[model samples]
Target: MIKDELRRGIIHENPILVLALGLCPSLAVSTSLQNGFGMGMAATFVLACSNVIISSMRRIIPDKVRIPCFIVVIAAFVTMVQLIMKAYLPALDKQLGIFVPLIVVNCIILGRAEAFASKNSISKSLVDGIVIGLGFTFSLCILSIIREILGSNKLLGLKFFPGYEPMTIFILAPGGFFTIAFVMAVVRYLGNRRKGA
Candidate 1:
């Protein structure tokens, strides 16, 4: 059912914390909540739309060339998103920069296209895209919360404590790995505990 699928996407098969897909963008844009949310939403739009289009055209697409077809579909939606962002959210577009265009090759989107969307019905693929996209967004936001707080000592640009020394490392690549590793470990521990019960 859709409910179970939703649960799995959010927990069991999260694109970042579990599936470990799309790690590059997650690391690059997760330094701030604003950037995280923006990237997540943009990717979600492309994923969902591409999933629907691919699922609908799955049978007609030649098996050997299906991968390229999926890329074309995903890239088309991504272009739409890029144009929309440039017009309405110029600063965010500038901040996201190349990663926005790089969504064309995002494994989360392409993986879903190959592994799920192509084989599933349109409705199922759409649901998968939405839930998985949301899972990606949720993970990015959580990571951003940790990074922004520790690295900048602020949330949404409001200072949490005056004159507190922020750990600048959290904004760097190593810190991204550290934060993701810690979160993944905690999540696995909880999952094991639940299964043992």
Candidate 2:
């Protein structure tokens, strides 16, 4: 059961590719591998921590104010993550900028909180957070790699080909859209093929 839940998040229901949640960060911070990775880790930490707390306190949280409660919990975690990042990873923190604080409103985190965490056991919710966080991180990494490589002819800030001209568009807003569209198309194609099989 646990294995199935984990697989579902990573493959069957990826937060970005499959579910299409949290696209703002997906497109913005994905300009580089480091940015994507740092953002992912920070969001993952919040997600996991929030899930555990929310799940454990599910009964005490009144249904009428559940949404507000969730926001407060998520925001607390986001603030902690932001402070920690600022302290230890200031460079990456600056690169991510507003996106770090924006994690408080990330649909993926809230969605999981309401849909799974509030109704499930602490152990299950924890697993859900970890798996879903991994899925989001994986998607960000893939998008970042494609954009960085094509847009700058570099990977992790290392030049791939000194003489090659990079397509600057791939790192811009349009590039993010194009990359997402291409990936979604490929994912759809693979899903169709799997269904047919």
Candidate 2 clashing pairs? none
Pairs clashing in candidate 1?
A: none
Go through the candidates in order and give each one's C-alpha lDDT.
0.90, 0.91
Give the number of the best model, judged by lDDT: 2
Q: Residue-pair clashes per candidate, as listed?
A: 0, 0
The local distance difference test score of model 1 is: 0.90
lDDT of 1 by residue, 30-103 (tens): 89888888788878878888999999999999999998888888888888888988999888778776678878
Runs in model 2 deviating more than 4 A are 88-98
**Candidate 2 per-residue C-alpha lDDT over 1-197 given as tens digits, one digit per residue, 9 for 90 to 100:** 87897789888989999899999878888999988887888788788889999999999999999999999988987888788889998887788767878798799999999999999999989989999998899899999999999999999999987798999999998999999989988998999999999
